[model samples]
Target: MSWDPYATLGLGRTATADDIRRAYRKLAKELHPDVRPGDKAAEERFKRATAAFNLLSDPALKSRYDRGEIDADGNERMAFGGGGPRPRQSARAGAGAGGFGGGPQGGPAGGADAFDLGDIFSDLFGPGFSGGGRGYGRMRGRDIRFTLDIDFLDAVNGAKRRVSLAEGRTLDVAIPAGVESGQVLRLKNQGGPGVQGGPSGDALVELNVRPHAFFRREGQDIHMDLNISLTEAVEGGRVQAPTPSGPVSLSIPAGSNTGKVLRLKGKGVGGQGDQFVRLLVMLPEVPDEELKRFVKKWPKRDQAPPRPS
Candidate 1:
């Protein structure tokens, strides 16, 4: 359809190489096969965006395209600018040693092997066409996609996973440790077969890391609120704290207060981080008269109350 590359990538002709790259990356993220699986329209746009970015990212090729020396596909345009078909001229001007004004069997003016038309054609239509006529005979296979959701701990700790394909076939998948939401894992040659002996497309697994019931993430650290009785906050004791790996006994310092962050080293995802436990001192539903009396008459209790952290 003679689509302009800039238009395909949603950019102007004046866009710099970096601008083009940024535009492509943004579009690719939104339209990746794994992101919008089964959406053929988005897939087509994604491919076009990729191709346009590739063409515009090369300085020589982009300059040639801007000068009308080449088309968006990096092919020399059939008609130069607005002029008619330009005659192929000699590389050294006039004619070669073997020919002059047509002669020596009308040998190409420059050298014996003047130009490589095959290379030009190949460049124009991707590396698919090799001969005189243009063709996409061996088409690449269509990529298949699947959404895989794993538990938060499993995702953080890494686990052997499996997925059931559309055909009801189960395949084992390796879940990488510390994998984040929206991450894509590629499965080679697990998609649709290629046409005319082309290589098969890949299987794209879009991973979703489920949120933990009590745990939250910050960088590599895991955070959760550790609830303890008000008495425990005043008296030091060990309490059971949940880690992604399992429940572990965590020591609470005497006089521990609410919003206190306690660290457990090497307890976070993949053992690369520490687990931060935020202490939440819970008051007894049944009020303690002695504790209430003590708090009410505690002389130095509130010269200044601690501010919220």
Candidate 2:
């Protein structure tokens, strides 16, 4: 494709360096391979945007490009003098098979111009390519980020999950126990592939723990409300209670009212915290005729609970 650094970065010739940077960052965040795995079109756009950024980020390169001294690929344009555009002078007199940006073959000089591809690469890849070095330089790959939604139990108990990547690839990620929402798990060497022999980047996975139906967590403690019949609350007996691990037996105290809390040690997050079970005394949905009649005649029924002062 015809590379236009300004257009690729969604900018114009009048755009400032800061403007260019902002545009590139916005596009990279939206078009990065990790954001939309296996989307070729976005990946291509990402690569183009990166290339454009590299070119435009460097002041010298940006100036040269703006002046039409070099093309989008960093190859020098036809050598133009004060008079007008002119062909680059070939080193070989007869061999006109010039390298990049050289005159066409069989031109003034039969041989191609001795252009150093390494020099061009050194300008683009940033440092380490100089000192008369040849071939592509090494550059570290870009870091990738992803969001992984997991069940609340899985966050409390360490679990393994597979993360999907581009090209039908998968990465196994280990979620630590007691991981909270917004926590990031980093996998080294799991991002975009490096350029040449450079090292690959890391993969950052942010956790999004899904909410439970009735259970809530505070710090390391677990809290839930357990409904109990009026008989069980007044008589005080053992009843089944729900926990993250499983159902457990709970003892209710006599005359227990609503908002009574029961603590189960070592039954919370990671089996190290505590579970607070609040008792909710509930009456039958329908009124019982026999109970209603008995209450009306009972003398103690007139004794109401003391109200707050």
Number of the top-ranking candidate, with lDDT as the measure: 2
Give TM per candidate: 0.55, 0.60
Candidate 2: 10-residue stretch with minimal lDDT? 100-109
Per-residue CA lDDT of model 1 for 224-309, tens digit only, reads 99889987899979999999899999999999989999999999888998999999989988888998899889987778765698
Best by TM-score: 2
Q: Write the per-residue lDDT of candidate 2 for residues 197-265, one digit (tens) a residue.
A: 446556666677889999999989999999999899889999999888889999999999999899999
Report every candidate's CA lDDT: 0.61, 0.64
Candidate 1 lDDT score at position 6: 92
